[model samples]
Target: MSLPTSTASPTPTRSTPRPATPSHRSGYRTGLRWLLQTHGFMFLWALGMLVVLVAAATIIVSNVTTPAGSIVQHARQGLTWFPFSIAIVGITTYTNIHIGAGLTRRSLGWAALTAAVVMAVAYAALFTLALQLERAVYGWTGWAHGVDGAGGLFTSSGQVGLVVLDVGLLFLAGQLSGVLVGIVYYRAGGWWGTLALPLTAGPILLATPALSTAALGDLGLAPRVVLVLLVLGAMSLAAHRLILGVQVRKLAT
Candidate 1:
C-alpha cells in the first residue's frame, strides 16, 4: 500500500546551554586585580614624589638646624590622605564599573577591603623603613632622630614593630574611613555625608596613636589597640552593609 506511510515523529533538537556567570570567588579575584591594576601605578608615583620631597626637606632642615624628630612623620599626613582619597574613588567610581562588569557587590567590598589592607601594610613598611633610614642619616650627622608627639606608642624609630603597627593601623583607619564617607555620599547625598563626617571620619582620629594618646592620655598600648580594632570592625561592618544594598546607577555621558 503507499509504501507504508511513515508514522515516526521527528526527533527534537537540543538547545545549547548558556555560559555560567562568574563565581563569587572569581569575581573577588577579578575585582582585586582590577583595583590594583588601576591604582598601583598612581600609588607608586605618589610614593616616589613623597620620597623626593622628604629628601629635600631633610637636607634643608639639617643645614638649618640639627634635624630633630622624624621628618617622614611630618609627611605622614600626606601619605594618609593620598590613600584615603584613592579609597574614596574606589567606592564612588570603581563600584559602578565593577558591577557593570558582571561582578557582585560582595566581591567588590571584599576586594576593596583587601586593597586597603594591602596598601596599609605597604605604607607602614615603607614608612617604617623611611624612619630607619632617617635615623641612620641623623646618626651619621649627629642629629636627633626622635619621633614627634607625646604619649605615643613608640618613642624611637628603632622600635620597628611598634612603628609599623602604629602606622599600619592609622593608614588602615584612614582608608576605611574614606570608603565609609564615599558610600555615605553615594547613598545619602552630600549634606548627609558632610554631616556624617565626624562619625565616619572618627576612626582615623581614634587610630592615630598621637591623637588618640593626646585625647585619652596614654590608655596603654593594649587598650589603644583594642579600641582601634573595635572602631575598624564597626566601620567595616557598616561599609559592608552599605555596599551590599547599594543600587547600581547609570553614568552620565
Candidate 2:
C-alpha cells in the first residue's frame, strides 16, 4: 500500500490568463460611442427643438412687427457656442474618464475629430432646413426676409448649398477651436489657456460667414475651402499631439 501511494501523483491545476487590453481601434469605437451617446445625440435633439421654437417665434414676431431681417439668423451664435462648449467638455472631462476606461489617447483624438465632423454636418443640415422653412413662412406672410451684412455668405436663404457650406465650416471651426482651448487649459493651466485664446479660438472667428465673405469671397469657393481645410488640418494635428502627451489629472468632485 505504501509503495502504491508513493507511485501516485496529484493532477496540476491550470491558471486562467487575464484578458488583454482593448486595441486602439476598439478604443476608438468605444470613445465614439461614448461621445455620441453622452453628448452628440442629446445636443442634436435639443438644437433641433430650439431651431423649431426660434422659427415659430420668428414667424410670430415677423407677423406682428413686420421685421425686415431673419430672426433665425441670430441663432447662429448659439449654435457656434453650443458645440464649442461641448467640445471643451469632451476634452477636459471625458479625456480623463476615457483613459481610465483603458482607451488610448489616439483613439480619443480620432473620436473627437469624427464627432466634430458628424455634429458639423448635422448642425449644418438643421440650420439649412430651418432657413428654408423660414423662407417659406416669410413668402406666405409677405414679409421681406432681408439679408444683413452678418449673413453675407448668401444673398438669400434660398441659397441652400451656400448656407450648408457656411454653417458646416463655422460649426467645425468652433468644435476644433474648443478642443484646442480645452487641451491648452488642461495642459498649461488657466493663465496660459486664456492667453492662448487668440491662437486657440481664432479659427472659429476666421471661419465666420461674414468674415469669409468680406475677406475671401473674391477668391471664390475653392480658395475659401482650401483655407478652411488647412486650418482644420493644423488644428487637428495640434490636438492630436497634445492629446498624445497629455497627463490625466484627477477630476475634482
Candidate 3:
C-alpha cells in the first residue's frame, strides 16, 4: 500500500506569467505628462497675453500716430522672450520640488526638452496665425499692412515652413539657454552663474541670425540654419549633462 501510494505523482501547477512592461513607453508618457502639468497653464496664459498685446498694439497703432509696423516688432520680441523667462524661472524654482515629489532629474530634463519643443512649435504657429489675421484685418479696414524686416522671417518671407524653422530655432535656443542658466545658478550659485553668462547666452545669441532678415556674415541660408541647429544641439547636450548629477536643494535653501 505504501509503495502504490508513492508511485502516483502529483499534477504540476502553472503560475501565471507576469504582464510585460513597456518601460520606455511608460517613461516617455510620464515625462510628457509631467511637462504638461508644469507648463500647461503657462502656455495658455502666454497665448492670452499675446492676443491681448496684439489687439492693443493694433488698435493703438492704427488709430494713433505710432507706426503700425511697431506692433509686429513688439509681438515678435514678446514671443521670443516669453518662453525664455518662463523656462528660466520654472526650472530653477520647480526642479527640486519635482525631484522631491518622486521624479528623477533625468526625467525632468527630458520633460523640459519636450516642453521646449512643443512650446516653440505652438508659439511659431500662433504668431504666424496672428500676423495673418492682422494682415486680413488691415486689408479689410483699408489700413496698410506694415510688416517689414521687423515682422520676422515668416511675416517678411511669407513662407510658413521657413518661419516655423526660424521661430522654432529661436525658442529652442531660448529654452536651452534658460535651462543652462538655471543649472549654472543651481550648481554654482549666483556669482558663478553671472560669470557663466557668456557661455549660457551664446546659444540664444546664435538664434538672432535665424530670426532676423539681416545677412549672416559669410553664411547663406543653409549655413545659417545648420549653425543654428548645431548650437541648439550643443546647448541641449550641455543642459542634459549639467542636470544629471544636480543636488536637490531644500525649499528654504
Candidate 4:
C-alpha cells in the first residue's frame, strides 16, 4: 500500500504579477478621469484668452511702418499683461476649487489640489506661448532687432538683475495664495469661506508689477510707483491674512 501512491501533477503558475494595488489603480484612474473632465472648462476659457493673446501677438507683426522695433517692443510689453491676466483667471479657478472641495470633508484636499495643478498647467502653456510669440516675431528679421540686447533669464534681455525680479514676483504671488489659504483654514476651518480674500489680493498685487512692466507702462504708472503699490498692497493683504488666521485659531482653541 505504501508503494501504490501516484505522482502529483505540477501546479499552474501565473504568467504575470498582479497589477498595481486596487487603491492605487483606482486613484490613478480617478485623477485621470477628473483631469479630462475639468480640462473641458479650461479649454473653453482658453478660447476667450486666445482672442486677446493673438491680438497682442499679431500687433507687432501687423505694423508695416516700424517693422524692426515692433517685435521687440511687443515682446517686452506683453510681459506686463501676461502675469496680470493669469492672476485674474487663476484666482477664480482657485476659488472654484475651494468651493467644490468644501462640498465634502473627505474630498476637499483633492479638489483643492486639482484646481491648483490644473491652473499651474494652464499658466505654463500660456507662458510658453507668449515666449514663442516674441521669439518668432523678434527673430523674424534677423539676429538683430536694431537694439543691442542681452537675454534675460527667460527673455531676450539679460538675466543678471532681472532674474531676481522675475523670481521675486512669482514667489510673492505664491505666498499670497498660501498665506490666505492658511489664514482662512485657521480662522473658519472651512474651504469656501477662506478663498475670496487671497484670490482678490493676488490680482491687485499682480496689477502693480504688471502695469509697471507691461508694454512700456501704457497703464500710466511710473515704475517706481508701481513698485511702491506692490509692496504696500502685498504687506496689507499679508497682514490681513495673519490677523484673520489668528482670529480663526483663537476661536478654534
Q: Tell me which of candidates 3 and 4 scores higher on lDDT.
A: 3
- TM-score for all models, in order of appearance: 0.86, 0.83, 0.81, 0.39
Order of quality (lDDT): 1, 2, 3, 4
Backbone clashes, each candidate? 0, 0, 0, 7
For candidate 4, the TM-score is 0.39
* lDDT scores of the candidates, listed in order: 0.75, 0.74, 0.68, 0.40
lDDT for model 2, on a 0 to 1 scale? Answer: 0.74
lDDT of 3 by residue, 1-253 (tens): 0112211232122232432663333333455565555566787887899788778877776677644452544566677777777778777876776676655666566666666777777777877777677767766776666655533454453465776777778877887788888888888888999999899977787678655666554446677778788888888888877876889865563
Model 4 pairs whose backbones collide: 77-215, 150-157, 151-156, 151-157, 152-157, 152-158, 187-248
Mind giving the per-residue lDDT tens digits that candidate 4 earns over 1-253?
0111111221122243443543322332343234334544645565466647656655745564544432333333334334334433433333334334322221223322333334444444444454455546567745334322322223433332343344334433443354344445444455654456555345435534553443333433246445644653554345343432242123213
Question: Which regions in candidate 3 have their CA more than 4 angstroms from the true location?
Answer: 1-28, 65-70, 154-157, 250-253
Estimate the lDDT of model 4. Answer: 0.40
Count steric clashes of candidate 2: 0
Residue 38 in model 2: lDDT: 55
